[model samples]
Target: MPSGPNSGRVSRSSGRWRWSDATRETTDTPTAATLETERMKDRYGLEVSTSSAEARDAYVEGIDRMLSAEAGVEDCLAAAIAADPGFALPHAALARQHQLYVRPDEARASAEAAVELSHSATARERQHVEIVRLLVAGQVPQALDLIRQHVIDYPRDAFALAPACGVFGAIGFSGRIGREAELLEFLEPLATHYGDDWWFATVHAFALIETGRWDRGRQLAERALEQRPSTPHGAHTLVHALFEAGDDDEAVSFLEGWLPDSDRASVLHCHIWWHYALVLMAVSRHDDAWQAFRHNCLPGTTTSPPITVFSDSSSFMWRSELAGQPRDRAIWQQVREFYEERFPQPIVFVDAHAGLTYAVLGETEQLQACLTELQELGEAGRLPAGTTGATLGQAYGAFVDEKWSTVIDVLEPLIPQVVRIGGSRAQRDLMTNTLLAAYVRSGRTDEARAFCAQVVDRRPTRPVAGFELC
Candidate 1:
């Protein structure tokens, strides 16, 4: 068996077997003791800290479920913690889940507990817990630095590497230029370490899709789903690749078949349904799109994380109006209430969508307040996305007022930097659609045609209403 900090050797002494961390030289070892020790390894072949088999099993289950966006992650992690309260990794994993679901206080406490417990853990496990600790504590830059180093040392530490992967990951929200490309570059080198691993394939596929390698991404996503059909992350990544490839019909068909088997309580369920609604809109199934939104993507209806609920609800509502559906103040109001209840501070991606909600509701006071905060954060260098959110907020306000020229002026320059705001390109299409609308409404027909032509070259379909006139 491969040996590392996590590896252990099993020995029989005094008519009993015990596991120890002492390194043993390989000599074509195929002893019964060696075989028994190998069974103690994790799914990725790393030896875990816990001696309890039940704790290790539960921890592995929780980590796999979390990576796949499956239901019962909390239950599994809690079971692991209950089985072995001193296990540091499960505490760190639970903290990540709490953070994702917007339970900041719980996240912090769990993270701190993990850090405290990690003093007795392996070096790899200690580093892993510390990375989660930094992330939950909002020390993202330091966390990212540690993540990069940790992955280099422990490439199979999937949970530790996860925060730096995908569109909403640390690199995705790094506010750095060419972050999409950066993510691809970061993941490409790690592929050899995780060949055909479902979770790795899903995340890597998302990175590929984001960087415009849709065909390859789609292939990888399909392979991932085949490996683990229950993975909502795999399904969601496939939806993104299909959306980018302009395969609306196929995307809708795939979702219809896949979603029935997915648990609605899963973390990515609402987001996956949001993708379904998007494809329905692209195919001009406006009524179906609205139904999908009201049932799955709405703030009140969705069981997703608060950030997912806020962003999906607000983005879908705004895009529905852009697609010629009448604006519903009631729906926007629900989203606003959810945002207020869940997010008391600015999260760049959620704040960007909240800007749309405020502007459309004619809540200038609230919109300006958000813009002011973003501007202040940007000025102080406190915002990772810097001025991107503020700029988009301005564009949303101008968009609502029908100041097409101002919308164009503000958004055109901001387009290149929009990736810093943190979301998949498809989500950011809310901005692109807004700019396209402005171009068409402002009678800049040539510019609209030119801009839209660029879009069609990439997407091959334009779902926005009035786009045909352009």
Candidate 2:
């Protein structure tokens, strides 16, 4: 909520004045004056208009690092801000980084600074700051509206395109019906402007996969990876393309090959490993999958946002549980500890995952605490997806209590709208799987069989054994 700024503090990156208008007199800063002699344009052919060449170079490199899942993006962004404190785009970029890192307070501060400073920025920089501000505020629908115009105006603004076109992007995560179609429609037209751009290739490939263009998506992902071997977004798209194409073996091999050097701080770091774990689960390699979870996905292993950590860890455990894999109580204990440390309050998706751990571990008090809060939030109409979450929290409690009928009653009607809570089809399947399992467990054989068939038809390539009622 920090907007239309007045000299606020931006959370420091490395004990430095991370956000300040350092010597903006132009004449006073001799070094900036000297460095400003040469000007360079951005990828969109828009002049960066920074006082320091080093800052411009660092900003571009930082963007690449972030897109590629490499380290040093923070350092580079910090350097850019230090060199040119009034650079609105870098401030905007820093805002995005802060949001990704789950420091919303810092993100808003940076975004506000970007907005205020953007008055003097070029049209491109202003656009960048505005879009980023919308993103930081979780206004995806509005951000998409702006991005639609942005693309028409500056189709080559690949940096702006990155967040808009990602698999976990505003469009993908918007929970709108026909999101796949939306992604395809939004990205397909702009493909010409971003020819061979590695980030663009990855995003377009993901859109293709979502829209059922699996072969083309895979080919594009592969080409992108070839261009930038460390491109995590490309790797992510390829994983999805392979999954959709029913090629689990290649998916496993590809992820394993990349796991060795996956940057711990990169956005895709934990998520790629999550994909690897899912592929292993698909192959029924439970032990290896658990190994991956322990090594790559345990709480402290990577710097993925809380949302990623919550989904990946909870889904792994829930999937394993559904598969009848023996529970590692120690890891569950670790997961519980991690959850407690990170989430004292639960959003809908995070709440359900927290309920999973609490139920499995018989932590009744913890589960009730989350449920109580969720119910309160739901009734107040402040929750994103309405009262379904509160109902699910109750369902989870009933599920733990072995009250299968209660679980079915709560979730059956809500199943159609499950995507509203946000998460991809694959991720939301945890809820569907739970309902199916509950039906079978409750001895409702006919209903269980019918639901199982429906699920199989929807995800025909999934391992048949996982969907079986018996």
Candidate 3:
């Protein structure tokens, strides 16, 4: 057996290849073994220590599978645990899965198990465990603070950095006014540590584009794809940069080529389709946009959680309505049915979207029920006081009742704080559009025109088809 860059021991004979079992020893010490996969390494270049070499291989495989949004991630994690019961990192990874599934109880249990087993794990593994525990416990501020320090202490920890810089990451969802600025600044120092690395370059490009540095962002994102053409994160960043730069032709061409090969099980797959639909709409391809929406980004079309599915579906319907594209009202009813069955609670952002659906569909009963839920949540301190759910619901109810003045009164005060709902600026613009439409419907054309000019001045790239200055 021969050993080299990877932890595995390789052998060659008669044009055949095999990994030698010599890498494994029946020893009590946690040690690197031959079970490491060929050409696999963590961001830090260390082989994960485990009693069973197969467990180490399984853990590494699971992490890679997760990055590509492949299926069998849980099966891989379970294999790791079955191979080595005390492996803490795999348990922490499982907690992330539970978190995304919106099963907080399961997430908490898995995260606690990781913490309990961390006493014998490496320092890096222990830190990862802490991160999972804090996130699952709903201690977001503490989790974010720890992530910042963890990256500084272990700059090569992609596990920590990915979640910190991701589109739905802690900082991305933090609701800070200058979030893009903060992200770009934070990433600059880490460049020296992760020079030209594919994933880091992709995330940095996203931050750059979000901060309006489109030229540099485009260059970096394209470079990341050149190195790894199938990198979904790179493709996602490039799409955003292209859209923001007003290169609609290139954006459409790139996404059309990219989406077919994207893993359907991956969370980003539907989101990339959402971007594709927006590009189609930008070019007056409304029918094509609706086709994309119905076939891919719609709620029942994908396996994404109700929260994510609702966000994309509601935004797509509203955008189509803005373009004067005719849609069956039955789609609205189907969406409302799904929302009622899946999400009975007012989960801040989900509530905002559900309220939009109910108002657009004229489901007065559901709209009133949403308001009732928000009021109950607010009083119990489950949701923040003055949450967007509460305000957006009020605005929607008023819009339905033709009390447009009351809609403006409820929404205008909260527009600045709407970022608290934890979506991208593009997504939050749904609320702004709703408010502007309310102004138009109420015959406050003068105020609506002023608002349109202000918004167009602020976001020149945003489509302003419906808010025409008539």
What digit string (tens of lDDT, one per residue) describes model 1 on residues 1-470?
11333433332244222334444322232456655666345567776777665666677778888988999888878877987899888999999999998889999999999999999888999999999999998988899999999998899999999999887899988888799999999999998888668888889999998888889999989998887788899899998888888899999999999988889899997899999998999899999988988898887676789888889888888888888889889988888888888888888787677688789899999899989998999889988888789989999999999999999999998887888888999988888888888887888767867876665325735566677733
Backbone steric clashes in candidate 3, count? 0
- Stretches of candidate 2 off by over 4 Å are 1-39, 138-141, 439-470
Q: List the pairs of residues colliding in candidate 2.
A: none
lDDT for residue 44 in candidate 2, whole number 0-100 = 38
Among all windows of 10 consecutive residues in model 2, the one with the lowest summed lDDT is 1-10
In the order shown, the candidates' Cα RMSDs to the true structure are 5.8, 7.6, 5.7
- Looking at model 2, residue 109 earns an lDDT score of 97
The best-first sequence of candidates by lDDT reads 1, 2, 3
Cα distance off (Å), candidate 1, residue 387:
1.4
lDDT value for model 3? 0.71
Report the lDDT tens digits of candidate 2 across residue range 126-231: 9978999999998877988898888888887767877776546776556455666788888888877665667777778877776667789889889888877777
Off by over 4 Å in 3: 1-41, 51-53, 68-72, 375-386, 399-413, 435-470
How does each model score on lDDT?
Answer: 0.83, 0.72, 0.71
Q: Report model 1's TM-score to 2 decimal places.
A: 0.91
